[model samples]
Target: MSVSTETRIKWTSADLELLPENGNNYEIIDGELYMTRAPHWKHQTSIARITNALVSWSNQSKLGQTIINPGIIFSDDNNVIPDLIWISNKKLESCVDEAGHFTSAPELVVEILSQKPNDIKRDKETKLKLYSNRGVREYWIVDWQLKQVEIYRRYEGKLTLMITLLDDDSITSELLPNFSCQIRDFFL
Candidate 1:
């Protein structure tokens, strides 16, 4: 009798370079490759609104920087492009690499959930675990379709579910001092 074994390919950041710029988003989580097509218009709008709020606050506070769709490379096999990220000036200096990608975790990471079930799972479960394990201080999962935001804050050395804000409610962050916005703003 002959014994055969199957070998699975563990994707890495190097493999991402081989893919064409085809208007799709690709990420490697735990050595697995996940891809999604371009997001919907509402998704883009939500990002814009969130960016505007974060950027405005960051500019005034001068405490950190807010960026959209930055490639955060925790490792060769654990890289992701989050919807948005806000990193303190101190942490940014330490985590950013010469290639201009974040080599480590940021202060905060945000993900605007897409319509697809897989994408939703990636944000809420897979990426949540990845960010928590890698020491991200805060993580926000925004569901524009539902007009809600789930905020996770670092607690006892891990990201913990702190609160969920509905459309009528406002959102605030301890990581970002004095930063507040209504949940409805994200949908608008």
Candidate 2:
């Protein structure tokens, strides 16, 4: 099977406008449209575990709302579909667009790295940089296979890898007060 090269895909705001109302999982980065199929069972399991934990915490407290696999527009023409996003209600209300574009950056974003070589590299390096440069306060890179999570926080005008948690270590977010999850539980 041949994947479409970036040059072959022409991206525009109008193109994004034509996406189905039901919504499809896609992202446009630098005008290169990337279509993602449903993740594998292992990936979905990990995501469910992590998302459930965040949802529980967010629900009880007013920390933020955890949205899973939502369409997020990063720029006028750059759209990104993050695995998860935590946006304060204030941010969510203010960033609204009828056309599905988010006018503001998310406070926290999570990207679960897939086993595919191309995806792994892009999630770790490229998307990591893009989210940070766009002023996302905290970014979490979840490595399901390794059972590890890398936490990155913006600091001094750059995104720095603050720590990597493994096994039973609890992953806490500086962006969301009192938000946490045990790394081991993320795999369950």
Candidate 3:
């Protein structure tokens, strides 16, 4: 699981403090700082499409607020930057921390899987379990390469695959009530 990169920096709260207020994104996983180079064009397109769809649905229907690329602090030492998160306003207010960690997990978290094989595996399996254990009721994994989005639902203390949505299909989340997205818009 290690990429053996010499240029990487170890992460700490100080490093987090030192980050510029610029729009660049970073995630701290177990004391390792993982900085994102700008996501590719297709990735950005997909991200925007999903964010727009979720926000529109949530706002009009009153399911929850659509949060885009916010820092989700999983622990004192672990901070995650999810691509999209949908949290009820009540949840958002209750979860804010003095240092800006999301103390509470969102009801739905969406991760757009990168093309790298390690990333694909990490998002599909490791992150899915992590979110489920952390009480995210719905986890969506969007695979650009595969042209599919896998929706996972937490049931009876475990997460099970609810559906694999193809490009022509429309997918919705149970946690957010009426939030839905067209599958093709994500890949287009």
Best by lDDT: 1
- Model 2 misses residue 20 by how many Å? 8.3
lDDT of 2: 0.81
Best by TM-score: 1
Which regions of candidate 2 are displaced past 4 Å? 1-10, 17-24
* Clashing pairs in model 3, backbone N/Cα/C closer than 3 A: none
Evaluated against the true structure, the overall lDDT of model 1 is: 0.93
TM-score to native of every candidate shown? 0.96, 0.87, 0.82
Write the candidate numbers in order of decreasing TM-score: 1, 2, 3
The parts of candidate 1 lying over 4 Å away from their true place are 1-4
* lDDT, each prediction: 0.93, 0.81, 0.78
Q: What digit string (tens of lDDT, one per residue) describes model 1 on residues 31-56?
A: 99999899999999999999999999
Candidate 3 residue-wise lDDT, 90-138, digit = tens: 7877998896658778988899987767666767776676787789888
Candidate 3 lowest-lDDT run of ten = 29-38
Q: Can you give the lDDT of residue 71 in candidate 3?
A: 78
| Clashing residue pairs for model 1 | none
Report lDDT (Cα) of residue 137, candidate 3: 83
